[model samples]
Target: MRLFPRAGPTASMVSATSIVVSGGIAVRGIGLLKLIYAAHVFGTSDAQDAFLEAFLLPSLLSDVLAAAVAPALIPALIRASTEGRTAGAVALYRAAFGAGLATTLVAALVLGLFFPFALPVLASGFGKEKSALTLRLLLVMLPLLPLTACNVLWRCILNAGNRFVLAALAPVATPLASLAVLYFGAARWGIQALAIGAVAGSAVEGILLAQGVYRLGYPLIPKLKGALNRLGPVLQQFGTILLSSVLFGCIPLIDNAMAAGLATGSLSVFGFGTKLATVILSLGPASIATGALPQLSRLAVVGDWRVMRGSLLHFGKLILLVTVPIVAVLMLFSGQLVRVVFQKGAFSTQAAYEVALVQRYSLLQVPLAVISALGFRLASSMAANELVIPAAGVGVAVAALADYQLRRILGVQGIALASVVTQLSVIATLGFLLKRRMSKQRLGVHTEAVPPGGDAL
Candidate 1:
């Protein structure tokens, strides 16, 4: 595939890409430092395992809310703005913000209340002490649900307006706060310090993003009037995307549950490895996809299918160019990477080796995972959000089965392999569906030539 247009990437695209990628790298760098600190301080102890498991619910809720809303919302906002319907766009944002806040509040309350009963089932392997500790940490973390949802909503709004830097950089505070708290208080407060740090971080992140949104001239005071009318289509699209997210989101929970059933430190090892892989993902595919979404949405609004097709293809090549080499290096030097990052203080050489094993398999999914992320965003931009759900469902089922069967043989490595297989399966199925849809639409046939040096924003 061609790496670039004959004239090369436009200045606007290059500028936007650089801003998003650099911001993402900075955020991930802070996160990596936090992880390294956590590894050194907590290692793979039961306290660490409890903290990781406790974090699962709140983090999953945040991701699901963000993923479900952002893709659908950004496109709608772009379309409305393009059509000079700024009032309608602002109203829609309010409605989404209000609805998301309410939903997060309700979910947090329900989860908090029910966690006492559900903790046993979710972490069945934990003893009474560990399980109780997890419950306490979870309750403290529950407030993060609403804070995170708002932060994500504001970030999406800023992104839709092409203000990528602030949106991307605002999240850096979360890790910074967490790292500081852990550094100063881990001895006195133990795992609970992490929880406190997370809540503090979420607060900072939300405030910074909210300020960014306001500075962009979007109203923070939500106007719910006419929001329902504008939200009808958005909600419909969100439902399909949310369903897909929930289906795929459960895979990690399932993996964690299975890991809990293994040895004492299995959950920590798996969590560490997964976090490392996510750092790579956020830096490349996730960053590229985020930068591309606004452009894709604008293109779709203008019926620029030919350009959209070309853009998608170009993105695929770009993502692979970055992801493939990183995956290779990580797989080949997994032990070295793990030791360099995690083997300190409480983290033992054996712990590093175990994490390395899982990291190697998890890194295998980086390229496929990136492609799948981009594909889903492209599909959402075209209002084909419902198309990938079946593929995701199938992938999740396969992952569960694989986790069950593989864990019996390879332990944590088996779980990691299952995740890789799931991503591959999902990407294959989704890519085929996307290609078939584009073929049917004849998107490859250029209908109108885009002007040279057109800005993607």
Candidate 2:
């Protein structure tokens, strides 16, 4: 028997895909279980809102720092390492780690000082006591910012080094750690336990990612120069990407926040629906997009326009293929889904209707949202040209304005509609931009290859 089985990039992709998809399933299962336990244990509108609100800034900040950098960092690092620029790859790691540490600390301080000011804006429906609890939770959760960002840096490095299985599986560590906090600590520590769980999860995730990086012969060090010089470009693009991600994300965030204010327990309803939608989006679309980044980057370097285009088309079709079925199921039996998932202990049938409404509306984004996420990742992976950001920003602005205008009139459902509309806008813009970039890459290849009107037949 051959000791080292013959394999190539294609085999790597197949194996990585299996690992990612399975990891997603595992994470999703943990998430479902946690939500069930939390609903039972916390069991109140206020408790749900407190946890969600405390989570809001940290979650969004993670998106801005870790996730924003993950796709961007992985492709660039892969290119650097493949081209024998080991120092450049190492420099990238150092820069990202420094940035994460600095950014997280700054964000934590800002949250500490300003969280009180923002609390009223976020949880306007809560009484002073509930609002204070929310604020306390925010302070506790803020520390996770730096911790989570470090986790992302390590994970991105590992993924770039083609250690996909560990990179994929590492995320599950956080949720499992959180489950322990909820199971044992919630009763004694109250909502603080949830916050502790998040922080502990971040620490575990960071350690796991760091261990994987070390195994791949990469060290975590602080390099100020590369981070400083290259950061301008990355940060500029990141700012736009952050805006786009936030704006797009703000749709549901605002919807959930607003609904929570309107009716008691409305927050939980919206949250339950959002989590369900996340299962589909994260497992299928996000997994594929993430899995494809390194390949896309390599294709860009080799000027493989045809393969890139075909890959993009495959991604779009893949999203539709997976999302259509999910949409059908959610549209047909949203209440049942919500009921089976929650609807016990503190959750009531009335809460189910509110959650069902959000879920049913979320079905509108089924195919569109999945395609948009793929488009964004695909565009970012193609040399980090930063085309997806402005287009996404435009969509977000549209969603925010629509959300504000429609929230009062249509309520939570309106918020969902706004989200759907913005996501469709993003899908359209990203699709067009991807085509244009592919054409440019093709034209550039043609111009460089054929010099002075000389053709050999």
Task: Tell me the tens digit of each residue's lDDT in model 1 across 3-111.
Answer: 5544432334545677988888888898889888887888898999999999998998888887777776888888889899887777888888888788889999999
So what's the TM-score on candidate 1?
0.92
How well does each candidate superpose onto the true structure, as a TM-score?
A: 0.92, 0.87
After best superposition, candidate 2 residue 312: deviation in angstroms?
1.7
The 10-residue segment with the lowest total lDDT in model 2 = 448-457
Question: Candidate 2, residues 189-242: lDDT per residue as tens digits?
Answer: 987888898888878877888887887777766666557775554455455556
Per-residue lDDT for 331 in model 1?
87
Candidate 1 lDDT score at position 399: 91
- Superposed by TM-score, candidate 2 places the C-alpha of residue 164 at a distance from the truth, in angstroms, of 1.2
The C-alpha RMSD of each candidate to the native structure, in angstroms, is: 4.0, 5.8
